[model samples]
Target: MKIAVCGKGGVGKTFFAGSLAGEFVLAGHPVIAIDADSSPNLALTLGLSAEQAKAIVPVAENEELVRLKTGTNYSGVFRLSFTVDDIISRYAVPTPSGASLLVMGTVKAMGSGCACPAHSVVRALMRHLVVERDEVVILDMEAGIEHLGRGTAEHVEILLVVTDANLKSLETAANICRLAQESGIRTIGLVSNRIADDRQEAAVRLFAEQHNLNVIAQLPFDPLVADAGMTGEPLDRSASSAIKAIGELAKKLRGLA
Candidate 1:
């Protein structure tokens, strides 16, 4: 399955994506967790050391922007010389349980008309993974839906949007839903994070109902999650309320316990 997790900044999207991938790995599925966020934190959430994650070099290509001639028949060709396995072997980090992790490093913007080679390469690799890879591929995307708009949306089977229990966060979720609809990507549901009390939970549900969105899961505010983040611990094994909620959400998504 190809799952893409996205939301506004500070919405715990990475946490949800990482935890879901970890759960799948624990359930005996070979999983590939792609940290598509330029400012990535999924590696930390998955309990990977910084040194281990840094081993995988991102797909960096320098391509000249040239229009292809009509009837060139170049659709199946790739510009890169490296195979996916080679790239992964060189750059991917394996967790203790055998799941693989890949990070898409950040790229700086050049002047207008400047090509985005990193974005192109990441998009190509992602497409290959979704179409050819047998393992479950989970992409943890950045806050905005821009990546989805850039043709990656079709590769996603489920688009999970995360949000906090606040009016601004709910508004962002609604906006994301609209963007996803415009991009022709189907949303699986919303996961409300950092709920402080019953009132906040009620607010999240009401917001989802008003927007015609499904509230698939609710995660309470937990200090352990913060500590785990600080310590680079795996959230899947944490006993925190938020982590437990994420595990349940993973089961719901997988149609199993």
Candidate 2:
């Protein structure tokens, strides 16, 4: 399953994506978790230590790799096509969660359709991961789907727009849903995270109903999750009810696969 998780910043999409990847690993499936966010912190969430996560060089910022793949002899030219399969084997970091991590760092001009070498490399890799790879791939996207072109986004089997009960978060999720639909993604759903009670969940469901998007999962607000984040500790899957909920959600996603 090629799943893309997106939401406004701080909506816990990275946490959800990381936990979901770990669940798939626990299920005995190979998983590749892509940190496609502009601020790439999915590494830490995937059980990498702070030092290891900080040491990661995003694909977009790897000058030597970009020169090898897209650089040209001409002063202002680059290759549009290149084999990116080796990139995974060469750079994917193995995490304690049993999932491989690939950080696709941000390109300053990414959303503007820049054809620079770095952008070209990132785009090609995105296509390779979403459309060509066999493993279960999960992308923790940036603020929206604009970073992913239609061709790449179309191949994503599922687009999960995560949101909290905040009005701004729901609004951002609605916009993301629209963009994903336009990108030709067939299965799009809303993941309501950090719900404190029936009232919050109801608000999210009402928003989803209004926007005609399915509410796929409703995760309770777990203080344990917050505590882990504050202390930079790996979430305890054995103790976190939120992680268990994500495990069940992972099964539901696997059903689609």
Candidate 3:
């Protein structure tokens, strides 16, 4: 299954995406976690050390790789199509959770139809992963779906929009859901994260109902999970409330598949 996790920034989209990738690995499936954020941090979330994360480069920022795939001699022209299969084999970094991580830095001005060589390469790679790859692919997308073209968005099987109880977060979630629907995605699930109490959960639920979003899961705020982020430690899969909630959501997604 190809799943995209997107929402407003700082809404815990990376946490959910990384946890779901680990859960898929535990279920005996090969998982590929893609970090499409401009400021990529999924590497740390998937258990990579700070130094290791710093050492690895993002695909869009890799001048050599992008030029190799899309560079052309003609002025201001580039190859529109190329094979990205070799990219996966050579660039995907293996994580401790048995899942591979791919950091795909954002293409600047892509939403404005920038046809630069780097943008072409990144766009092609995104399409290749969602439409061609057999393994389960989970993308921690940018703050909005504007980064995804219709071709890429339609191929994704599920889109999980995450939010907290904050009014701004819920507003962003509602906009993302509308964009996903317009992009031809049929199954859009709402995930509420970091709910501190019953009142917060109720607010999220009410917002979802008002916007016609399907609330699939609610993950309580776990202090241990937050501490791990600060200390650069991996989350405790066995004991984390957020991890358990994600595990159940993974099962529900597999069942739907």
**What is the lDDT, from 0 to 100, of the residue 245 in candidate 2?**
88
All models: lDDT?
0.70, 0.90, 0.88
Which prediction has the highest lDDT against the true structure? 2
| TM per candidate | 0.80, 0.97, 0.96
lDDT tens digits by residue: candidate 2, 98-132 = 99999999844346857788888988898899999
Off by over 4 Å in 1: 54-56, 60-85, 107-116, 149-151, 231-238
> What C-alpha lDDT does candidate 3 achieve relative to the native structure?
0.88
Using lDDT as the yardstick, the better of models 1 and 2 is: 2
Worst 10 residues of 2 by lDDT: 107-116
Clashing pairs in 3: none
Model 2 / residue 95 / CA error / Å: 0.6
Q: Residue 213, candidate 1: how far off, in angstroms? A: 1.3
lDDT of 3 by residue, 1-257 (tens): 99999989988989888889999999999999999989898988788888999998899889999889988888877888888989999999999878999998885534696887777777888889999999999999976777767578899999999999999999999998998888898799899999999999999988888889999989999887899878866667788888988999999999988
